[model samples]
Target: MGKWTNLIKQTTDSDPISGAVNTPIQLSSTFSQADFDTYGHFDYSRSGNPTRESGERTLASLEGGKYGYLFSTGMAAISSVLFIFSSGDHLVVSKQVYGGTFRILHDVLPRFGITYDLVDFSNIEEIKKAIKPNTKALYIETPANPTLNITDISAVVALAKEQGLLTIADNTFMTPLTQRPLELGVDIVVHSATKFLAGHSDILAGVAVTNDDELAKRIYFIQNAVGATLGVTDTWLLLRGLKTLGVRYKRSSESAQTIAEHLQADKRVVQVLYPGLSSHKGYDIHQRQASSGGAVLSFDVGSLENARKVVEHLEIPIFSVSLGAVESIISYPPKMSHAELNSEELLEVGITPGLLRLSVGLEDVEDLIDDLDQALSYID
Candidate 1:
């Protein structure tokens, strides 16, 4: 928005000619600085683009961050944060996080001689006990990945601040509208724009926002050096997707609450893991920190065989690995998302073969329920 609030109102609104302010796919790789300004800036697409810059500024404004950088994918944005660390440094992360993030922390970072601890952040004592002298950052995902366990944001932020450790939070599921970790004592906030942030499944992208100037400089250097920035078209798509995020999330969450309630009473369901449900383990903590419970929920059939049958027969919820889309989706965490986790670890996190994670979409609740009901009949 050119560091101006008035720019935001104009840029976000539809272009007067076609009702879309963002240009249609600005793909020009290089720009002539002399034509615009005497000093050189954003000379190449690899370094920057007007379309991408617009999206970055929009996101940063939403998250109350001074800067935002778009990336090729969520993992890329997350990995860029690791640029702050090096060999001998340690990272403290939550055990119940996205499988991709878990693997990066446990498998890839170790190769660089960086150590990590997968701790139960729900219990602040666990985090305190696990901290080592080398701990550089405390990485956390509240309403943590599959399990839906939540860590108290204020407590974690307080402890991290006291320990002189950088605080990093994954706000993919919540988006900035629901949760602003940056305002809650966090140093950096990251998002998988592929998910809720984009509000549509059309693009695969990631974004990072922060208030720290030095951290922004380091991340900018990392993106330039590593060269994993999102394309101009993708950035435009993400921005377009972001425009309707508020609506999509609200509708999806409404459907999810209905589905969670419908499933919780089913005899075939062993558990319905949704933060929106008052019975959920993280319901209180999530409510305290977030404006609304998210749309994704996980529930387990009585057995592994039953889970397979349900997914196979579902007519409404698409069977897939990814989440945060317009269509309802079902996934088996064990074989799908978290396959890399050993059997023991999978069981420990309650990600049995029977565990089916449902990503609620903006669909008719009755239609979704009917489809799910018919699928459950196939399980028996």
Candidate 2:
């Protein structure tokens, strides 16, 4: 089947008992045991739910993985994956990861004795130097947040394989529709489904998918043990959102390309960070691995004052935190997404005060360009 056909088919499932076209949400907190020794598939909601199971199966199929798990939030899903490693394990991670991810690694994980080294994933040598005898995994976010720096997924996975390390990728930016990391040799793929998979700004959800049977068992055990599973309602909503991901992302990516090109030509813009742009540092490599340049792009206007001016004058895109919605969103990395990092830390990772990340949506490309032009006009 074609990707579009598979996308809709895999995401949509019917309720067997109700004869309904949509998967019915099972709201029961617990189910009765069929016999003394044999319990139903879902004995408790924390461990599993019918709606969540269906959603997970769909997610796994979409990502070309064998197993999938849903979580309460994106961070929860990531943290659960990290928890799979033992206390003494070390990890090599991309430096410019999401703020929440940095927060967990910088603050939360240390207490548990797990250590990590933040390295520039664009440079494979840096990743190589960061690995220690205790290193257990290489975690990355391609088209990395705020900067839109692309990492060669296959290159990184190859390195991980040679070193006997697990490779985990955060596919929130691309989603499974654009890039299936597992197919490219990634051991596990994670997403903050709240951003793209849900397609609406209403719910918070997360997903983790893996093809390895042993890894799947470990992830499932953590998901069940931590009790941070998605609710039945959100699971059903996520499924609904997934059905339209193909069309939504297509429109969003197209708009983003036009916007990125427009920003690149504008004199007020110091730099445009988008894989769709031919001049982007990772353009050639990105083209090799992913089908689209994705919907998010970032740009710098030279200073914090100029950034404030542009953001304040913006009319169309809402000045908000999250991305990947029907509505366009503009985010300031220093404050909105990477607030946990200090000024020095942010700059070190190339997240400048002047940087603005835009998550393009299903809007008229010309209108979005004009709105951005009007806002950027205030910078001078």
Candidate 3:
């Protein structure tokens, strides 16, 4: 079946009892055991729930993986994955990773005796230089948060394989619709399903998928042990949201390309960072790996003052933190998404004070453009 067809069909599961089109949410915390010796498929909600399991299986099928796990939030999924490694194991991480992931690596993981080296993933040689003998995995976020930097997934995976290290990728920005990193040889693929997969900003969720049986077992163990699994209600909502992902992503991406071009041509904009723009450093590579430029773009307006002026004056996109919604959102990295990083650390990753990340939505392209024009007029 085609991807779009599979998207809708895979997410739609009929209720066995009522034959309802939507997957039924099983809210029971515990199920009756037929016998003490033999438990049913799901004995406890924390270990597994019908709704969450259905969603997880669907996600695995979509990402072309053998196993899938869902969590209460994106961070929980990521943190659970990190728990797979033993104490003293090291990792090679993308420098432009999301703030929460960075916090995990910088603040949380170190206390567990896990060390990581931040490297510019665009430069494969830098990644090689950063890898130590203890490095067990390579972590990356292609079209990374805020900056939208692209990393060659296949290239990184190949390098990791040569060194006998696992390759983990955060596929939140591109999602499976645009780029399936697992298909590109990534060991595991993770997503903040709260964004594109859910399509609406109404839920907080995370997903992880893997093809390796052993890795899947480890992740499931961590998920069951940690008990941060997604609630049945949120799982049902996420499934409903997945049905419309194709349409939502297509419309948003088309609008994002138009907006990126508009921002690129504007004199008030210092630089536009979007893979859709050919002028972008990683445009060619991105085209090779992904289907679209995605629905997010970032631009620099010269200084923090200019950024604030444009953000405050913007009447269309709301000034907010999260992205991938029916409504457009504009966020300042220095204060919002990447706020955990200090000034020097942010600049080192090219997250300047003037930079503003915009998540394009379902609004009329012309109307969004007009709104942006009016906002930029206040910049100068």
Candidate 4:
């Protein structure tokens, strides 16, 4: 990751007019035409903006992809990639995905005749079993949302390639620093740049990167046609955040592993779901593929009342919705991120009433542990 730190630090060198060290935010909605019969590289803001382009270029380079498209939100990024599939197409998705993603697959896409099968990727046999004649894509979220389930990217990509299906991976949790899906043979890698890439919660953004030229073109077209492109200011903000991603993630991951171990040893804690822990089922595979365990983890407090008490009592981490910020985020996934699911659906996906997700921040590990210990004391 030291190499990634250096790579991210290298500025875009794109300011031809000002020759500024920092990338300039091109706020103009429309660029001037050079001649009566020709146009410049950028014609309109929705299609292309210098600021957004700079961010996209950096992201594409980080993920080792040919092109990257920025979007208004994480969902927008995923939607742009999925838009490539027409009606009557089918997709194979991971069983425990983000609630928003599941909602789109279950509620919205069906309206257009697109169908999906949610399979437990922990068992690759299930993924193979779920594939069918109409299945055109394999959508995966490794170290999956809230549950921390890790899938074998290389195996899935190979299976998809053999089946003549495109592979799409949601790399939001790990980012390119820890795991690069494109390099692992995934066709498309999407991110909720609002999380770790931004490194702070101030801006909302998303990015989709791919090595395939045709897929990139389609996503770029959808980005413009759907009109979900990111704004000039937030694009620059994400660029600033990317500069320190390596250092921030490294520090936060150390703290996350520490917190996960601490929670695991406590009698009141029912389970600690972190790939960093040896007890985690995905620990070995995650270690093989990712540089680190990443900065997020989940634990159960054994009861709904205990979980509520801990959230109400914790002082350092914010009891909030999103994750991967300067301040630690302690969220109840069953109620927050995966609220779209009912009690039965939650149980099916291993999200219990007492399950809580923790996004380790830049806070001192000792401080986070102390704060969590005091909060857990309230459970008894």
Q: What's the lDDT of the predicted structure labeled candidate 1?
A: 0.84
Cα RMSD, each candidate: 3.2, 0.8, 0.7, 1.2
Candidate 2: deviation at residue 148, Å? 0.6
Candidate 2 total steric clashes = 0
Minimal lDDT window, size 10, model 3: 34-43
TM-score of each candidate structure, all chains considered together: 0.93, 0.99, 0.99, 0.98
lDDT, candidate 4, 189-261, per-residue tens? 9999999989789999999999888888889888999999999899988888888888899899999999998
- Candidate 2 wrong stretches, greater than 4 Å: none
Q: lDDT per residue, candidate 1, 258-294, as tens digits?
A: 9999999998898988888999877888998898788
Residue-level lDDT of model 3, residues 1-380, one tens digit each, is 89999998899888889999999988899999988698789889999999999999999999999999999999999999999998989999999999999999999999989999999999999999999989999998999998999999989999999999999999999989899899999999999999999978999999999999999999999999999999999999999999999999999999999999999999999999999999999999999999999999999999999999999899999899999988999999999999899999999999998999999999999999999999999976
lDDT of 4 at 255: 93
Q: After TM-score superposition, what is the CA distance of residue 199 in candidate 3 from its true location, in Å?
A: 1.5
TM-score of 3: 0.99
Candidate with top lDDT is: 3
Query: Relative to the unseen true structure, what is the Cα RMSD of model 4?
Result: 1.2
lDDT of each: 0.84, 0.93, 0.95, 0.91
C-alpha positional error of residue 89 in candidate 4 after TM-score superposition, expressed in Å:
0.4
| Collision count of model 3 | 0
lDDT for residue 38 in candidate 1, whole number 0-100: 79
Q: Model 2 reaches what TM-score against the true structure?
A: 0.99
Task: Return the clash pairs for model 1, or none.
Answer: 14-19, 14-20, 15-19, 15-20, 15-21
